[model samples]
Target: MPIIQFQLIPHTTQDGLPYQHLRFQITTEDGLMEPQDLKGLKLPENVQWSQGIVIEGKGPIWLYGYLVHECHPSSWVGCYDPRLGIVVVSSHTHAVKVGNVLPIQLPA
Candidate 1:
């Protein structure tokens, strides 16, 4: 399995509301895949979006907001098979910066 590196980028909306942009990169046998950015994901209020997390197959990865969210939502960002080196983000957006240095486990 490849290493999935995740980052949360802080940004301000036009209305001045604070939110985070989620970005990730895959490190596979070939090399580091291009970073993928996922915008407009509604994260939980308790999550601190300043740090990055890495998921290395210790178990399944789960996302949450008010409820348990899907990791690959059809509307936000599509599902990708990291082994194939194919990255899929929404057609309207492009990949953003690399993530933070901290390594933490994603919420189960």
Candidate 2:
């Protein structure tokens, strides 16, 4: 599995809804891969998403979601699977930051 570092940059939609731009990078034997960005992800509100959080990856498709911090116990949990091209979020409450990892999984 590859470990990726992610940073969430804040943005607002034309309709005035808050969203984030997910910027991340992965390192491989070939060296550090190019940084990629996923725009307009409407994540949970009120949680302070951190920058440079490291996470593990399964393959070319990465999962972006929230986690529970001792200080931040969230009632809501959500995930954004780029492979599925959809955002799945359940009931809302307190929350913490977001992180993910991305690796190009070559076929066996």
Candidate 3:
């Protein structure tokens, strides 16, 4: 199996609010995955469930809500920010950088 990487996209929603959503891309896989492929998606054994995909700096970005969208295989997964009313697709992920070291965690 290949390692699946996910990123967060920051954009405004229809109402023009700040928000971000998750977008997944396979690192070593040949093609995109279907919605069904995410049914039982789980992190690797070395990863911790408490770890979340960092969007900003060292802190974790919390999702206001989660939604399932009808999208192509290349970009899948959607989330909504009620506070800012923003929505994002095919977003990017941020890694915590400190001096010469960097740490990153993925959403479980």
Best by lDDT: 2
Candidate 2: stretches off by over 4 Å: 29-88, 91-108
Report residue 14 deviation for candidate 1 (angstroms).
Answer: 2.9
- Residue 102 in model 2: lDDT: 26
lDDT of 2 at 8: 51
Decreasing lDDT order of the candidates = 2, 3, 1
In angstroms, how far off is 56's CA in candidate 1? 19
lDDT of 1 at 94: 32
> Candidate 1 — which residues are off by over 4 angstroms?
31-46, 49-108
Each model's lDDT:
0.31, 0.33, 0.33
For candidate 2, lDDT tens digit of each residue in 29-69? 65343324223323334444432122223324433332322
Better model by lDDT, 2 or 3? 2
In terms of lDDT, the poorest run of 10 residues in model 3 is 57-66
What is the Cα-based lDDT of residue 12 in candidate 2? 34
lDDT of 3 by residue, 1-108 (tens): 544555554443333333333455455445544444555554323322222221221111221121232221222223333343222333222321222122222223
Candidate 1, 1-108: lDDT as tens digits = 335454544543233433334444444555333323123433334444332212222213332221123333322232223353112232222322222122222222
Q: Provide the lowest-lDDT 10-residue window in model 2.
A: 99-108
TM-score of candidate 1 on Cα atoms, chains taken together: 0.29
Model 1 weakest 10-residue run by lDDT: 96-105
